[model samples]
Target chain A: MKMKCRQFFEEFGVTRMIAVGFFLAIAIAVPVLHLNTLTLYSQALTRMAMNGVLVLTMVPIMVCGAGMNFALPIGIICGLIGGLISMNMNLQGFTGFFASILFSLPFSLVMGYLYGLLMNRVKGSEMMIATYVGFAVISAMCIVWLFVPIDNLVLRMQMGRGLRKDVVLTDFWAGILDDLCPVTIGGLTIPLGTFLFLFLMCFLVYLYMHSKTGIMMRAAGQNPGLAAANGINVDRMRIWGITLSTVLGAIGILVYAQSYGFMQFYESPKMMSFSAVAAVLLGGASNKRASIFNVIFGVMVFQGILTLSMPVANVLLPESNISDIVRMIISNGIILYALGKGSGKK
Target chain B: MKTIKQFFSENLVVIFFALLCLGAYLIAGQAPYVVVSDLINRVMRNSILVLALIIPIMAGMGLNFGIVVGAMSAQAAIILITHWRMTGMAGIVVALLVCTVISVICGYLLGMLFNKTRGQEMITGMIAGYFGNGIYLLIFLVLFGTVIPFWDEELSIRSGIGIKDTLKMIDGMKGAMDNVWKLQLSQVLIAVFVLYTLYMAYCIVKRGRENRSAVKISVIKWLIWGAALAAVLLIPSVSAVVTRCKIPMITLFFVILVSVLCQFITSTKLGQDFRSVGMDIGIAEASGINVNRIRILATIFSTVIASWGQLAFLQNMGTFSTYTAQQNVGTFSIAALLVGGASIDKATVRQAFIGVVLFQLLFLLAPSAGTKIFNDTQVGEYFRTVISNGVIAVALVLHALNKNRKKAAQADSI
Candidate 1:
C-alpha cells in the first residue's frame, strides 16, 4: 500500500496534484458561496472550448523538444493579420471565420519555418529566445498595425490613423461556432459547435502524432544523436514539429477570437501564451513532453478555475480585481513549479 | 583594417543603437540643452537598475529577469517607510535597510529556483517575476487592511481593503538624494576630471618610485585626458548646455559607488568563484568550489543592489504607480545592458554606462521623432519597444550562434 501511494504521487506529480486540488477547491467553493452553479458551469465550458485549441498548440512543439511555444504571439499575430484581411474583404459568418483561418495559414507556415530554423540554431536556449522573439514580433506589430493600410471602416480606429485595440466580430462571425448547436440541460448551456471544432483539431493533431513523420520527430526530440545516427534528419523533423505548432497556433487564435467576440490586438496576446503554457503544465505535461489529453484536461481545469474564481472572489472581496490576481498566481505558479521540476526528470 | 572589422563586429549592437539615437535626435530636432538635461535625469533614474543586472550575468545566470522580484521588495519597503511617514535621507536609509532584508530573502529563494531550473533559468526567472507579482498583489491588495490591520486615509482606497494604485511619496522623501548636493553638469565634469588627474598622478609617482619605465607613458596619458577635458570645457555651446544642466551629485555618487563596488567585487575571491563557475560549471565543481553557493551569493548581491537601485529610482520619480512600477524593471534593464554590448555570459561596468546613456537618449528622442516621421507619437513608442525587445532577441541569437560555432570548432579540434 505504501509503495502504491508513493508510485501514485510520483506518477501524478505534486504540481498536478496541487492543481487538481485547487480546481476541486474552487469547484466546491462555487456552490458553497451561493453562486449560480449552472451559470458558472456554462461559462467554464465556454471558456474551456474557447481556449482549448490554443492549449493544444503546445503538444507538437513539446514532443519535438522546442520547449514551450513562448513565441506563440508570432502565430497569434499571423492569425490577427489574417482575421483583419478577412474583415477587410467584408467577409462574414462561417465564411469569414474559415476565410480568416485559410488566410493565416501561409503566414504561419513561413514564419514557422523561419522560427524553426532559429530554434534549430538556438537548440538548448529555445524557450528564452522564443519569449523574446514573441515580444519583438508583438511590439513590431504595434508599429505595423499603425501602417497596415487596412481600410476596413469597422476595424480601423475611430478618429485616428491605426487599427482599433479591440475589433468586434459581432457583425462578422462572433459565436458562429459557439452558438451553432449549444445544448441545454437543467439550465446549463454547452457550446457544442466550439467543442466539436476543438475536438476536430485535437483529433487531427492526434492522428498526426501517430503518423510516421510524427514518430520520427518524437525520436529526434528524445535523442537527437541517436536519431541522426539512424539517418532520421533530426533538424528537419524539428522544423516540421515547429511549423505544425505554429500553424495550429494561427488556427487556435481565430477560434478564440470567434468565441470571445473580440480580436484583441497589440498587448492582449502577450499573456495568452503564458496562460496556455500554464494550462498544459497544469494538465500534467512537462517541459519536453505533452499530449492531447494534457491539452483537453489542462484547458478544462485552467479555464474552469478562471471562470469559477471570478464569481467566487467577487462575492468574497467585491470591487477588487482579486480574480485577476488569482489567475496570475495560479498560472505563473504552475509554470514555475513545472520549470523547477526540470524537464520532468528525477 | 582587420582590427577595424573586428571592432565593428564586436560592438555591432552598440554602434547600431548609437547611430539610431543620432538619427532619432536629428529627426526629433530637440534643443541640445533640453535633451541633455532630460538624458541626465533618465540616466540617473535607470542606470543603477541596469548596473544591478551585471553580477548575475557575470555569474553566468543570463539576464536576471528576477530583478523584478528585487524591485518589488524595494517597493514594499518604500511603501512601509512611507506609511511610517519617515522623511528625507533618513527615510531613504530606512527604506534601503528594509529593502536589503526583504530582497535577501527573495534573492535566496530566487537563487534556489534558478538552481532547480538550471539551463532554463532565464525563462524561469521571467515566469517567477509574474508569480512574484501575484504574491505581491495578494499582500498589498488583499491582506494589508483585512488581515494585517493597516489603515491610512491617503494611502488606502475608499473601500479600504487595499492600498491605492498610485502612491505619492511624502514631500520630504521626494528627491531626497537628488536635492542633497545638486550641481551644474559642467562643475561635476570638471571635478571628476580633476580627481581623475590626481589619481593618475598618484599612480605615476608610485610607479616612478618602483623604478617602472611605464611612468612616462602614464603621465602622457593623464595630460592628454586633462587636455581633452579642457578642450571640451572650452567649447562654447557645449559649456552652455553643460552649465545649464543640473547634475544630482548625490545620485551620481550613488551610481559611481555601485559601479566601483561591482568592479571591486569582480576582483574578490567570491567573484573569481563566480567567473570560474560561469566559465565552466563542471570544472568549477571539480575544483572544489561550492558552485551552487556562489550562484546563490551572486543572486543575493544582484537582488540587494537592485533593491537599492529601485529605492533610488522611486525617490527620484517622487510618485510611483504602486502596482505597476516594477513591471518593466527587468525588461528595460536587460535591454539597456544588451544595448551596451554585454552578452548573456559577459558584461562590464563600461558597457552598463554606455548602454544606459544610449538607451535613455533613444527613449527621449523616440516619441518626438515618431511624431515627426509618422505624425503619430504612438508609432515611435512602439518602435522603441520593438527595438528594445528586438535587440535582446538579436543578442540571444548571436550568443547562441557563437556558442554553436565554438562547440563545432572544439569538435573539429578533437
Candidate 2:
C-alpha cells in the first residue's frame, strides 16, 4: 500500500509541481510587481479563446492512441484558406462565417483522411513524423499560395503574389463573434459570442467523449491490437479520431483568425502547436488524456499567465519582451514534466 | 540487368539528389562563375558538423537528434577560449577540449535517457534535445558569465546575467582546420578525401585487426586510447602554430577519430553486446549481457559525440541562436542523415558524410537555384527551409512504406 501510494504520488506529483509552480510564480509575481491583473487576465482569456480550441482538438487523436496533434495547423491553415476564399467570394456576416467554415470542412476532412492514412502506415514514430510532415506540408502550401490566383486587387499585392503573409480580416469576419453580445461592466468585459462558441464546442466534445465511439477512441489509444480483437475497426476509429481533431482544429483557427482580425501567413500558424500544446498541458492535459474542463482551464490559465506576466515582468526587469522568457520556460518546463511523468519509461 | 536494377533501386535517392543538382545547374544556366569552389568550401566547413551525427546511427540509435548537447558543449568551450582571449591556434585547441568535456557529460546523460526508453529512441531524443535547449537557455540566458565564470567582461549580456548572443569564434580558432597549411590545394577538401581514404582503409584493416590474435586486443585498446589523448593535447598546440596560419586540424581529426573509434568499439565484443541489446533487450539480458550498462555506455557515447559535433558546428558558425540552435540542428541533421540513406534504426559513417554533403549541398544550392529558376528569392528561401524539412518527412514516409510492406508480406507468408 505504501509503495502503491508512493507510485501514485510520483505520478500525480509531476502534475502537482507544474500547478504549484504556475500558481506560485503568478502569486509572487502579482504582489511583487503590483501590475494590473485584469489587463493580463483579459489578454490570457483572449488567447485562450483563440488557442484553447486547438488544444481541445488534440483529444481525438490522442484518444485513438495516435500521438499528439502536431499537425493541428494543417486543418487551421485550411480554415484560413477557406476564410480567404469566402471573403473574396463576398460572403459576409453570419453567412460568411458559416460559408467560410463550410468551405474549409471538406478540405479538413480530406487532409485529415490523408494524414490518417499516413499515420496508419507509420505506426511508431508518429510524433516525429507528424512534426516533420506538418512542417513540410506547411512549407509546400506556402509555395502554392504564391500562385493561388485570387484576383482581387486588394488581396493580391501589386507585385502579384497570392497575398501578404498577413491578410487583414477586418472587412471580413474579425470581431464578429467577439462583438456578439459582448458585455462590459466596471472594466470587466466578456466576449460572449466567442465564449458561447467555445461553450458549445466544449459541451459537444464532452458529450462526444462520453459516447460509444468515444470509448472506442479510448480503446484505440490504449491498445490498437486489443481494440481490433474486440471487434473495433481500429483504423476506422483512428481515421474518425484524426478527422475530428482536424475539424475542431479548423474551427479553432477560424475563431482565432476572426478574433485577431487578420490571417498571418505560413509562420503565423506555425506556432499553433507550441501555444496550443502549452496551454493544454499548462491546464493539466497530459499527452494522452485531457478534458473539456482542462481545455477551458488550460486556455484560461495559460492565457492568464501569458497576459499577466508580461507587464509584470516589464515592471521588474524593465525589458519589453520579458514575457517571452517566462512563456518559453513555462511551456517547455510543462512539456518536460509531462514527458517525465507517468510510467517513467521513455 | 538485375544487378543494374538493384543498384538503381538501392541508390534511388542518391540518383535523385544527383539529378536534382544537375537540374539546378542546368536551370541556373551556363554560369561561368566557379560556384563549385564556394560550394566545396561550404562542404568542407560544415561537413564535419554533419559528420558528427554518424555514430548513434551506427549504433542503431537513430540520428543523433540529441546533437544540441554536443553543440552546447562546443559553445561552452568556445566561450571559455574567447574569455581567456587566447589568440591564434591555442584558442581552437582550448575550444575543442571544452567541447569534448561538455559533450561527454551531455552524451552520458542523453545516452542514459535513451537506454531507459529503448525502442522509442528518436522522439525521446527529439524531446530530450528540446529539453536540453531549455536547460541550455536557463544556464546561458540566466547563469553564464555572471555565475558560470568567464574571462572577458564584454561576453556577458548588459544585465550582467548570461552570455551575449553572438561572440566571434573565428578570431582565435574559427576556420582553423579549413585553413590547414593553405597548400593552394583546398586543403580542407583534399584532406577530406585523405580522411575518407584513411577511413576506408581503416574499415579494410578492421578485418585484419579482427584476425589478429585475441592477445592483441588490450594492447590495441591502450595504444589507441594513448594515441587519442596525445593527439588531443598535441593537436591544439600544433593548431597554435603560426607557420601557415593556426590550422585546427587536431580538432577536426579528433572528431574523425571519435567517429572511427565509436564504429570500432561497436564491432568489438562490447559493440556486439550493444547491437544485441538494441535488437532484443530481453534476449541480451538473458544472454548475460549487462543491458543496462551497455545501454548507459552507448547512450553516453552517442550524446557525447553529438555534443562534440554540435560544438564543432558552433565553433564554425561562431554565433548561436540561443534557444533555437540545438532544435534546428537536431531537425536538420536528422533529416540530412535520413536523406543520406540512414533508416530508422541504422546508419553508417559513409552515409552520415554523404548525407551531410548532399544535404548541405542542396541547402546551399536551393536558394541560388530557386532564384535562378523561379526569379522569386522568397521561393528559394522557403524552399531551402522547407526542403530540408521535407526530406525528413519523405524519408519517414519511405521508411514507413518499406516497413509496412515487409510486415504485410510476412503476414501473408505466415
DockQ winner:
1
Q: How well does each candidate superpose onto the true structure, as a TM-score?
A: 0.98, 0.86
Return the lDDT, model 1, position B63: 91
Error of 1 at A311 (Å): 1.0
The per-residue C-alpha lDDT of model 2 at residue A49 equals: 74
- Model 2 lDDT per residue over A1-346, tens place: 9999998666555654665567558746775676665555555556667776778887788778776777887888788778778877877788888888899898999999999998988876677688778888788878877767785666776684667777777777788888888766656567778888888888898899889999988887787779889999988888898989998888888888888887776666765786677677766667677777667877776777777776765675553354666566666556555655522543
Best candidate per lDDT, number? 1
lDDT of each: 0.91, 0.70
Displacement of residue B303 (Cα, Å) in model 1 is 0.5
| lDDT of candidate 1 over B1-414, digit per residue (tens) | 999999999999899999999999999999999999999999998998999999998888989999999999999998999899999889888998999999999999999988888877788889999999999999999998889999998899888899999999988899998899899988888888889878877887666777566887777787898788777789898888888999998899899999999988878898899999899999999999998899999999999999989988999999999999999899899999999989899999999999999998999999999999978989889988888899889888888899988998999999
Each prediction's total of clashing residue pairs, residues at least 3 apart in sequence or on different chains, is: 0, 13
Per-residue lDDT tens digits for candidate 2, residues B91-174, read 666666777777778877877777655655666676666666667776766556446664356577776666676776546466
Task: State the lDDT at A166 in candidate 1.
Answer: 99
